[model samples]
Target: MEPAANVLDLNQLRRSCSSCALYELCLPAGIGVDDLDRLDATVKDKRALDRGDMLYREGDPFEALYVVRSGALKTFVQNEAGDVQILGFHLPGEILGFDALATNLHVSQAEALERSSICELPYAKLQQVTSEVPALHRQLMRVISREVVEEHRHLVMMGRQQAQEQLASFLRSLADRYQRLHRDGSALNLPMSRYDIANYLGLVVETVSRLFSRMEEMGVLQVNRKSVRILRPELLAALCRSDAAPRRKDAG
Candidate 1:
């Protein structure tokens, strides 16, 4: 007869990165179990957070790379007058702390949008591990490069894409992210509210809502409360690529 499994203190058990759902997405492809074990050793704990709990604050000294294990998070920046601007929504399989990598100081704050858990990878330890595993070094560079490319894409979106087109692209992006995390892409769970979406998209809340309604009416997208479904993903995708090329405005 088998004994009952220990249920208490499961969080303290040795975590296997190979068992993680995001293993394929975040970690290097085709790495063996030994590599996975070594990578797992770099992460210390899976920290749980409540909604609105801060992962890190602006000006906090950078220490480790944070990977979203579950739920969602948002990064924001504050102006001199203390007004906050939503920067981006981060999902599982995504890494935070890239913005702080160069300066060793965070210029923005990351907060949980819902009940969340994250794996902590200490930077110094990661650097040492990378020396032992060259694949990880390349994987790290690829992850950082994706962030840079996304930022440049956003600059282009805000500069050239029309309001409706921008909203469509944003919805598509959310769908893609959720899909990549092994979630249902047809329907979305928007943890952040419309105001946060508007703030990120450079649009007002009313405009953002109106655009969603317009897209639904056009049979391109559908929204039910916080759940959005792309009715015609192909058409929506077309709209995203149909935007005019960004043009530089001359300072008069």
Candidate 2:
């Protein structure tokens, strides 16, 4: 017998929680209709940009926290000597642009890694909605807090982890984030290039390439250019824990 036909309308979802498919990931669940309506009125969605476009550069006056509606973006910055550092990658349902929350000026730049569109939550209006909805206010705080934790996690990895451990952590992170976005946890697309991954993980590009190859040999991962399949997710995740790194000759 043939498999049952998949039947689901993709167009029925609205920008707000009642009908939005990303309700669980994009917005805090259980917000009342009034709050949802307020959010729908304030959100500016579907703003598009091409690859290589800078969505917002450093020093630009900050206005809103942008959410990926489709496609992908990269947040990075240049040092005084003009070398670029990749900060993070944002996928659909991810919120970014909090750099200016306190000082009112952007410190890093956000650029499109592919043809992308984002929904802007104007900060001024977001502040108002948060005031009305206590849950939403707490939700915003949680988002900002996660970004802070991610920074600290990277610092720890860079300071103590070996190259394989760092790369393993990186792959596991990507797979986990994609899982949160409702994509397959076992196999997914890596929107950013190896260079970006290397910068974020504090490894050289060649070392990153070699790590992927070795992981495949160990049955931990399978890589085909930009796509990575986690063949041994448990082992890969274990590599993320302190001191659990697999012993290998080139682990240095």
Instruction: TM-score each candidate.
Output: 0.89, 0.90
Reference-based TM-score, model 2: 0.90
Q: How many backbone clashes does candidate 1 have?
A: 0
Error of 1 at 65 (Å): 0.5
TM-score of candidate 1 versus the correct structure, residues matched by position:
0.89
- What range of 10 consecutive residues in model 1 has the weakest lDDT sum? 243-252
lDDT of 1 by residue, 168-244 (tens): 78888888887887788878889999999888888888888877777787787778999888888888887676443
Judged by whole-model lDDT over C-alpha atoms, candidate 1 comes out at 0.83
Superposed by TM-score, candidate 2 places the C-alpha of residue 192 at a distance from the truth, in angstroms, of 0.6
Kindly give the number of clashing pairs for every candidate. Answer: 0, 0
